[model samples]
Structure formats: C-alpha cells, structure tokens
Target chain A: MRSDLVDHVMTVFGAVVRGLVYSMLALPAILVVASSFTSSDTMSFPPTGLSLRWYKKAFDSEVFMSALWTSTYVAVLVSIIALAIGFAAAFAINRFSFRGKMFLQGLAFSPLIVPAVVLGIGLLQLFAWLDLTQTIYPLLLGHLVLAIPYVVRTVLASLSLHDQMLEQAAMNLRATPVQVIRRITLPLILPGLLSAAIFAFVTSFGNVTVSAFLTYGGNVTLPVQIFTYVNTSYDPVAAAVSTLMIIVTLAVILTVERLIGAERLA
Target chain B: MKQSVLNRRNVSVAVLLAPMVLLLTCFLVVPVLGLLRSSFLPGSEFLAGNGFSLTQYVRFFSDSYYSSVLMETFVDGLIVSVVCLVIGFPTGYSLARLSPSARRWRTMIVILPLTLSLVVVVFGWLIILGRNGLINSLFVRIGVFSSPKTLLFNRVAVTVVLVQQFLPFMILSVMSVVTQIHPVLEQAAANLRANRFATFRRVIVPLAMPGVLVGFNLVFVLSISAFITPRLIGGARVAMLGSLIYERIMSELNWPSGAAMAFVLFVSGLGFTAALNALAGSHLITKGRGNAL
Candidate 1:
C-alpha cells in the first residue's frame, strides 16, 4: 500500500515537471505570436487589443518583401538541387555494395557535423578567393551543402524501409536497372522524396548563420534580414514578421505531420 | 558475362554518386580546406598573403582575451549540457513511456521551439527577459520589486536562450534511445521488487547511457559553436568563440585571424563529435528521428 502511494506520487511529480518544461520551451514563440496581434505599438503580454497593423507594416515594407522573395527563390532552388543530388547518393548507398560506400555516406553527412559558423566563414573565404562572393551562386551552393544532409538522411530512412525484393525481381525479369528504379524503387520512395524536399526547403529557408556571411548586394535572405533588423530595432513590427514566419513554419510542419507523419521527421 | 555485369553495376553506381559527391566536395570540403589553408598563410593586416606561416594561430593562442573567449565557450557548453541532461532525461523518459496520443501532443510542444527560426525565438525571449519585459513587469505589478530590472544582455539571458534552443535535441535524443529499449527489461526489474527509482537507476540508466553520451556531446558541441544566441543575447558582455570569429572576419576584415579562430572552434567541435562516435559508434541515436535541430 505504501509502495503504491509512492508510485502515484512519482507519476504525478514526473507529469508536473514535464508540463513545466514543455510550457517553458513553447513560451517564447507563443509570446511572439500573441504579441503580433497587439493593438498598441509596443510589445506586451496579454496584448491590449487585437490588431494586425504590424503585419500590414511587414507586408508593406519593401525590404521585408524583397528578403522574402530572395529567401523563397533560394530555398526553392536549394530544395531541387539537394533533392536531385541527395536522392542519387542515397540510392547508390542503399542499392549497391560498393567499396567506399561508408566513405560516401560520411562525406554526405559531414556538413551536418561541422559547425555553421565554420561553414559560414569557410564558404565566404572560398567564394571570395574564387571571386564568386558577389553572386547568388555562393548562397545557393552553401545552402545546398547544408540542406543535402537532410535529404540524404530522409531518403536513406525510406530506402531502408522499402522492399529490395521487388527491385531484384524486376531485374530478374530482364528489366534494366534504370527501368527498375524508375518503376519500382522510385514509386516506393516517392513519399520520402516529397518529405525530403519539404524538409530541405524549410532547412534552407530558415538558415541564417551561413546566410549571414553569404548575403551579397541586396540579396539578403529573410532570416538574416530579420536577424539584422532585430538587433537594431525594438518595435513590434519585428514581432509581427516573426509571428507570420511562425505560422508558415507551423503550417509546413503540420503538413509533414499529416501527410508523412511527424515520426518520419524524427 | 560476369565481367560485363560487374562493369555495368560499377558504372551505374558511379553515375548515381557523382552529383552529391561533386557538390559536397567543391562546396563544403574545399571551402573548409580553404579556411584551414588561409589560417596558415602569412597576412599583412587583414589580407591573407602568400607564404606559409603560423602567425595568425600564434596570435590567437597567445592573446589572453581570445583565450578567455574560448574558455568561456567551453564553460557555457558544459553548464548547458549538464542542465539539459538533468531536465531532458526525465521528460524523455516520461515521453517514451507515455501513451501514443499523449506522446504526440507532448512531442509537438517540445518540437515547436525547434522548428521556429532561432532569431525569432530569441526576439520573443528578448521581450520576456528584457528590463521592461514580462517577468519584470509582473514582478513589479505584484510588488516583488520597486522597478523593472535589466535582465537582457547578460550571461544569464544567453544561457537561458541556449538551454531553451537545445533542450529539444537532448529530450529527443534520449527519447529515441529510450523507445528502443525493451519494456520487458523494466518489467523484470519490477518483478524483482525494485521500486521506480531503483529500477531507473539500476536498469534503465545502464541501457540509456549511449543516448546520454550522444545527447551530451551534441548539446556541448552545438552550444559551444552557437553564433546568434551569444551575439544578440550575450551582447558585448560575453565573448564566445563564435562571436569573436564573426567580428574578426566581418568587422575586422581579418580573414587569417578569423579562420584560425574558426578552425579552433571546429577542432574542438570535431573532438567532441569524435568522442561521441567512439563511445556510441556512428549511429547517432537521433538519426532519422527527425532533424537534430
């Protein structure tokens, strides 16, 4: 009986601690989202009145709009590039028993392990050396390096779970390897590909550390622009922009959760 | 026929591997190599000059200010790792043991912070932890203080933001590993008349050690190399390796010095990750569990 009471107490205590931690983690973004609706000019919790004035300010500002456009085009390009290369790499690693297979996998995932600051400065130096710093190519290429690891990771996860027997049977039926992959392996891994694309897009769009160094001319990515702006400004317009970003992020994440299942994200 | 088949397979594999290998090599590997190379070259002021020299590295290592920045980074990393482990382990354990629906909601709450941009999240925290921000406002309203206190731009604010940013990684790492451990082992512990605490310490912990090590390494490496949090939140008060590298390269235009500092941070981060791989092997517990962010 005494032990049963102890067990009950422990369960309740664990739940409370979990609840507190979760709330603390979610609070910052929640506050940002909440304050975006503030009727007042300044940020405050339980904001005075509901208004979208700051969001209008965000939309009307040319700087924010241009940054958003830059972020979008770059992220789209990154997703496509990362998906194409990462898929081929992942497919080879999964389907073949080649020498240096492990090495290839290591190289593919190496960018994830390297610190962003290191990559940022390294890429900046490399681009400047090649006289490519002024172009958008460095930003595109840098983001590709960052985003490809996710592509490889997600694609690999799906490939492992797919049936190899189907591909083998297709080969035995005199189907060329291309035909087999196009018909069999590709169809099986399509969900993985879509999720990987979305994952890559979000990763590129949200990246700031590397983008901070690579933003040339007026082609600042949204996150970097936001970072620069927030450092100097205290107005609620920043909060409004952040709130909109949070909504979009939540939407993408929810789609991943609904379409592919959130477990796949992990 | 066998030789033809072998050649065909080789050709196909090579074709499939080319694009990713080329991209990673040209963009990622070469740039990192360039940084390392630049650090060794002689430089007049900010420009990296021809000829091999270790002057940049020597300058960084010999300067007390720079050395302190490196020390401060590691110390903050160590503290953050310990705190995350203490808090994240229990939450992860509870998450692993929870019913499916409950776990789903809980995991979302945990992951929401991670999915948002770090800059935006830090902004939110700025309001909450700033001088006239939520905490101070509430405290004063309740007569806890006479006036609002300056809470932002300090080590405490930086640490708070770092811990919040990285806690999800720790919890998810532990949760992934915890889920893999067979529940029957815990049942057996219960069958042996062990209480919950004893069972956790004796049975669960031994099995969860791999996850703990991986989580510690990840949190430590990430926190140490973090750039934005230390810059915006730490302000000018705290000097971390990341912020120093940024200032050197961006503001000071000292590529060799910046590269040297970056390389130092890289080597330390690499050391921690290598240690993690040795202890837990290449299969990070968090792999495919979602993005590590």
Candidate 2:
C-alpha cells in the first residue's frame, strides 16, 4: 500500500512536469498573439487594455502589405512547381526500379542536409556573377530548392502507402496507362498531394535565411521584412503581423489535420 | 516489340527525372561549386581574379577570433541538443503512452510552434525577455527583483529560445521511435520482477537510442546553423559562426572569407553526424534502424 502511494505520487509529479514543459512549448506563440492586442504604443504582455490598433496599423503600412503580397505569390508559385517536380520524382522512385534510383532519391533529398546559410550565400554569389541580382528569379529559385525536399518527402510517404493492385486492376480492364493513372492513382493520393503542396507552401512562405540573401530591391518577403523590422524597433506592429502569420500557419495546419490527420503527419 | 517497349520505358523514366535534375544542377550544384571555388580566391579579387590561394583558409585558422566563434557555435549546439534531449525524452515518452485521440490533440499542440515562422516565434521571445516585458515585470511586482534586468542580448536567452524552437524535432523523433517499441516488452520486463524505472532504463532507453541519436544530430545541426534566433536574441553581445558568416558576406562583401567559413560550418556539421554514426555502430539495438542519419 505504501509503495502504491509512492507510485501514485511519482505519476502525479511526472504529469505536472510534462504539463509545464508543454506550456513552455506553447508560451511563445501565446505571448505574441496576446501582445498583438495591446492598446498602448509600447509592446507589453498582460497587455495594457485590449485593442486591435496594431493590426489596423500593420494593414495600413505599405511595406508590410507589399511584403505580404510578395510572400504569397512566391509561395504559391513555389508550391505548384515543387509539386510537379516532387510528384514526378516520387512516382518514378516508387513505381519504377531504374538504374541510379538510389542516387536520384539521395539527390532529391540533399537540400535538407545542406545548411540553409550556405545555400543562401551560394545562390547570392551565383546570381551576382550571372548579373541576375536585380530580378526576382534568385528568390524564386532559392525557395524552390529549399521547398522541394519537403514536397518529395511528403509525396513519397503518400505514394509508398498507396496500393498498386488498384492500378493493376484498372490496367486489366483494358484501360490505357494514362487512364489508369488518372482514374485510379491520382484520387487515391490526393490527400498526400494536397499535404505535399501545403508543406511546400509553408516551407516557402516561412523562409527567411535564403530569402534574406536573394530578396532584391522592392521584393522582400514578409518574414524577412519582419526580421529586419524587429532588429531595429520594438513595437506592437510586429506582434500584429506575427499574429497574422500564426493565424495563417494555424489555418494551414488545421486544413492538413482535417485532410490527413495530424497524427499521421508526425 | 519487347525491345521497343523497353526503350519507351527508359525514355519515360528519363522524362520524369529531367526537370528535377536540371533544377538541382543549375541552382544547387553549380552555385555550391562556384562557392567552393571562390573560397580558394582572395577576398579583393572575388570577381576579377581566377588564380587560387589559401589565404582565406589560413586567415580563418590562424585568427583566434574566428576560431573562437566556431568553437562557441559548436558549444552552443551541444548545449541546445542536450537540453532538448533531456526535456524531449519525457514528453515524447508520455506522448507515446497516450490514447490515440489524446495523442493526436497533444501532438498538434507540440507541433504548433513549428508551423509558425521562426521570426514570429523569436519575436514572441523578444517580448517576453525584453526589459519591462513579461518576466521582468512579474518578478519586480512580486519583489523578486529591484528592477527590470537586462535579460535580452545574452547567451542564456539565445539558448532558451533555441531550445524552444528545436524541441519539437527532438520530441517527434523520440515519439516516433517510442511508439514503435512493443508494449509487450514492457509487460515482460514487469513480469520478470523489474520496476518501472528499471524497465525504462534497460528496455526502453536502449530501444530508443536510435531515435535519440537522430534527434541529437538533427537538433545539433539546426542549432549551430541557426541565424535569426542568435542574431535577434544574442544581439551584438554574443556572436555565432552563422552570424559572423552573414556579416562577412552581407555586410562586408568579403565573399571568399564568408564562403570559407560557411564551408567550415558545413563540414563540421557533417563531421559530427559521421562521428555519431560511427560511435553507434551496427549493434543489436541499432541494427534494424538502417542509416537513420
């Protein structure tokens, strides 16, 4: 009986510690969202009366608005391009046993292993040498490289879990290869594809290191803009913008959870 | 007919691979090669001169300031990874022990910060750790302190923020492996007269080492290469190798020196990954994991 009590106490202690750790994990985002509603000019927590003035201010600013637009379009384009390439590579790797298959798979995932700072500087140097620094191509291409690995990983996971017998059955019914893929394969993997696109979108949207190097005049991304802003100033506008970013990210994550179940994502 | 079919299959495979191959080669391979080549050139002659030299490397090695930055970067990486492991192990273990529905909700909360941008998250830290911010005000109100302390722009703040940022990776890595360990083994250990702590230490921990190592290497690499967190939180008072490299390339326009330092950072990360793998060889506990790094 004494030992049972000891075990119970130990269990309670473990639960309390775990609770605190999880709270620490969630504390930063919570603080940022809370401070975004501060009524005062200075940023503070437990916020001196609630207000949305900072959100209005963030929307009113041309710099934040333009940067948001840039980030959105760039992320959309990157997600589409990454999906096309990642789908093809993942399909080929999953379906066919070609020579250099391992090489292709390794090369496809290699960007994840390389440090982002190196990739940033390398692209900056390459663009400067090619005299392409003035254009938006560097930012697009840099994010594309950073975003593709995630797309491949997600798509590959989706494809691997897919059943091949359905495709075989479709072929047995005199369906053409294209018809088999369109009618049988695509629908089965649509959840994975959507999730892969979301992964690509988030990776591209949240990027700062590579974008910092590649963003040319008048083309800064939202994250980079916020980074630069916070470096020099302490204000609630950053909090408002950060809250919006969190809301967008949370929405995407919820959509993914609805589509694929967040547990599977882990 | 068979030969023709084989040729068509080959052609289609090539077609599927062509775009990705082209993109990676043009943007990733060529640029990295150029960066490596330029690291051998002198800083002043980055654009004009083609001749190779070891001046940049010598400068990095011989200078105490640069070398200390590199050492500090590795030390910080070590501290973050260790702290992450200590905290993440229990959280992941408990998470693995949860019911399916409960685990799902808990995991979403755990990974919520990961979905948000690092800049946004760091801004949160800035608010909390700034003078007259959350902790300071609370402490002063309770008479724990006389005034708001200079909490931001220090190593402790940087370490705390980094641990917060990268803890999810370690948790997920541990949780994935822990879930795979059969419950029956724990039962069997208990049946053999072992206590809960004994079962955890002998059965669970050894089984979970592969995941622990993967999380360790991942957190270490990420923490060392981290740029924005250290720059924002550490400010000018603390310098990491990543910030130093950023300053050289972006601020000073010394491409060669920056490129060399970047290469050093990359190699050190790779070296540590290899060393960890070597240390955890193909034993029974690590056998089925298959090159997790």
Candidate 3:
C-alpha cells in the first residue's frame, strides 16, 4: 500500500514538472500560433473551429500593412547605416593600434550592455528635443545606435583573422593603399560584412523596446502594430499576424544562414 | 619592398575611423550628455538646484509603493536570470560538447529566438497561458481541476515569459565561457574519486561563474527596463521601472523627472556591468601574466 502511495505521489509530481516545462516550451503554439486557427467569431482556445478567416482579416487590415512596411524600411536603413559606421570603426581598430583604442572599443560596445528601454528613453528625449521623434528617421537612428555593436564585433572577428602579411606583400609589390584594400582586406572580410549586415537587419527588424517608446504613428513598426493589436483586442488575428512574422523571420534567418553559414559568421 | 606605402597606409587608419568617430559622438556620446543635462532641469516646485537635487531620486526612493515595486523588479530579474542559468547551463554544456559543425546548427536554433521580435513571444504566451488555453483544456480533459487556473497577468506568468524569451541569450553567453574551460578539468575531478555533484560544485561552478555573472547582469538589466512583457503578461497590477518611466513622461508630463529616472536606470545598468567586466578583465590579465612564464 505504501509503495502504491509512493508511486502515485511520484507520478503526480512528475506530471507537474512535465506540465510546466511543456507549457514553457510549447505554450507559444497554444497562446500565439494556435490561436490563429480559430473558426469562431472571437478568439477561443483549442480554437473552437479551424479556419483561415482571421489570417485573411489580418491581411486586409491597413494598420498592419503600414506597420509592416515601416519596420521593413527602418530595418533596411538601420542595417546599412550600422554596417557603414561599424565597418569604419572595425577597419581603424583592427588595422592600426591607436592611443584611444581601448576607450573607442568601450564606446562602441557600450550599447551591448545598456538596456533597450533605457536607450529608448534617452533617444526619445534627445530626439524630442531635436523635434525628430515623430519621423521614421529617429527610429532608424535609434536602432543604429544598438545595431552598430553587432556589426563591430562581427567585422572585428573577421579582420583579426585576416592575413596582414598578404597585405604587406601586396604593398611590397607596389600596390597602392587603395589597391591593397580592394584586393586583400575587403574581399577577406566580405563574409563578415555580410554577416554583420544580416545581424543588423534582424536586430533592427525585430526590436520593439527601443522602437516602442520612440515610435509615433508614422513610425509604427511591425512589433508596435502587434502590441497595439494585442492590447486592444483578443483574437486569432494576432495569431495570424504572429504566424506571418514567424514565417518571414524564419525565411530571413535561413537566407542569412545560407549566405554566411550563420555559425561561422557569428 | 615598399616602406613608403606603409607610412601612407598608417595614415589611412585615421580616414577609416573619422566617420565612425562622428557617428559614435552623435549617436552615443551626445545623447548621454543630453540625458544628464535634462535630469537637473527645474521642477515647478520650491526645490530647484543646478548642482544636485534629489527631487526625482527622493520621490522614487522614498515612497514605499515604488520601493516595493523596485524590490520586486530586482527579485524578478534575479529569478528570471537564475532560472535561465539552471536550464541554460545544461543546454549550454551540451552544445559546447557537440562537434563543431553540429554545435553550429544547434546554436542557430538556439539563437532563432533572438533574431525575432519579443512582441511575438509575448503574444504567443498570452494564448497559451490564457484560461481557455491549451494547458487549461488539457487539465480539464484529464480531470486535474474543474476550473482553469488563472495564469495571465500574474507574477508567475511574467517570470515564465521572461525566462523563455531570454533563455537563448543566457545559453549563448554561458556556452561561450564554458567552451573556454577545458572539459578535462571536470574529467580530472571525476578521476580523483569526486562524485558528479562534487565535481560540478567545485570544478564546473567556479569556472562558469564568469558567464553566470555576465548572464545575471544582462538578464537583470534587461528585466529592469522591460516594459512590454510585464505590461502584456502582468498587466497594470505590476509597476516595473520601465512602465514607471513611461508613465512619468507620458502621463505625468514631467520630463525632468523622467530624465532623472532614465539616468538612474542607465547608470545602474552600466555601472554594475562595468564592475563585472572589470573583474573579468583583471582575471584575464592575471592569467595572461601567469602564462608568460
């Protein structure tokens, strides 16, 4: 009898642990993804019925489209800007040892440790002062602040691995500084540059913390759109939108991985 | 063969850094300066000073309500990070032990969470944790409980969401640090007749503390400033620092107070991280010197 009781107790405790872990990992489907499958007039769990209506509804929604475009455009620009700035800094930091190298390194990597919301507040206050918060430019600029760190680290890793001896040999052969750069350094680090650009793209593309407080109506990113939607209503439409986000993001990540072999670049 | 080219190439370093210098100043340095200056701007009250004023600090630190909220925020942060470490450490160790190519693919999967927006995750949790959600339905079907438990807009929900969301990052950071520690350290301990528990506590734990510190700092900083997850999961019941700052600025229309709060948040986050980084750097420096012999 005691053994039976012990077995029962063990089974119950085991289930609890299983339930919690399962919910932790699998709840995304229950909460976000599965809800997209409701065949009802309102959001229901186990989705009362399965249909594609809400997905269609989300697609027809104008606000969702606007926010999607906003995020795409902002992410594209932020990636480009972060790549340029980080490329410059990485080139300088790796190619030559300077007096302020440590300080500059810290300055570049500072945002990696700072919280996004804090960064957002500071950027919002600064941009508001400059009367620029309402526009998409501030949104891009705010993302650039955060995205540059990724670019710097990625490019720096590649640059350090690059063969300085080859560049020196090129110079020995009478190649100009420009020629050496074009033939040697840039080609070697292009993979890193590409990886950095992808990282920047994804970071900016998915960011909501810095983008949230900084975003105004015209500057509403996709995440902001999802936020407002979830806040105001409860429905499978959110699930549909989330499904959309997941698909697009998965595609982008895979493409980036293929281009640079995500592991090597990271 | 070309010494003259070396001189010009050295000069080219300045050209490479110039644009970056300008960007860093505008995007980073200048904003911090602006935030600091705005923190001291005059309030409409009697107490106003240029040098130092506790108007904002005093208000937040004095009130028991905000103080409780602050304590809760830190506790939640600690819990989230520690929970991540517990799950992430094993996963990280496993990933580290994998062959290089396999490790790469595993890392890609682990980091997929990071590459997407947090908004999706929060929204995802809501459906799953809701009263009529999967867990509840499963419980009812199995006769575990007649009524579905309320998991939404609660502390448990908040912590769960944060942990699931940030687990990948904790794993990545811990894996990076653990990858550096030779597995032979643990093996040696095991060979010396130490049980797994002893080996873990004495050997694994000490080596992994650096990553633990880093992961803890990041998760803490992130948890402190997080507005949306708690907003979505915990609702208005939980007053975290992130929402407080938002309310102070947007609702109260107090920009100076908002700036002060933001500065405090910024400094505290940076300050603690700097302290941790200093410890890690000094450790590395000492190890470097020891290796020179």
DockQ of 3: 0.43
A232: Cα error in model 3, Å: 1.6
DockQ of each: 0.65, 0.67, 0.43
Q: Residue A80: error of model 3 in Å?
A: 1.5
The lDDT for every candidate, in the order shown, is: 0.85, 0.88, 0.77
lDDT per residue (tens digit) for residues A151-171 in model 1: 999999999998899989999
Q: After superposition, which runs of candidate 1 have C-alpha atoms over 4 Å from their true positions?
A: A1-13, B44-48, B273-293
Docking quality category of candidate 2 according to DockQ thresholds: medium
For model 3, residues B1-293, the per-residue Cα lDDT tens digits are: 48886777667877787776777678667877776776776572212335556677777678888778777877888788878877777676666777887776566666666777888988877767777776788888899979899878888888988998888777777777888889898888868866656666677666787887777777778887788898888988877777787777766867777777777777776676688678877876676566345
Task: Summarize candidate 3's per-residue lDDT along A1-266 as a digit string, tens digits.
Answer: 55456546645654564345434644573356667878888765777877899888888999887888888888888888889889988888987876888988888888877677667767777787777766776688878888888899989988988788999999999998789989998998887798898889888888888788777756588888888788878777778988888777777767767766665443
Pick the TM-score winner. Answer: 2
Error of 1 at A56 (Å): 1.3
- Supply candidate 2's per-residue lDDT for A237: 97
Q: How should the candidates be ordered by DockQ, best one leading?
A: 2, 1, 3
Fraction of native contacts, model 1: 0.64
Candidate 1 residue-wise lDDT at A223: 88
Model 1, range B1-293, lDDT digits (tens) per residue? 99999999999899999999899889899889988988887784434387889998898889888888888898899889988998899998888888887787787778777777788888889878876678988999999989988788888789878988899889988998999899998898899888887678777876787888878887888899888988888888888899888888888888887888899999977786677667565443443233224
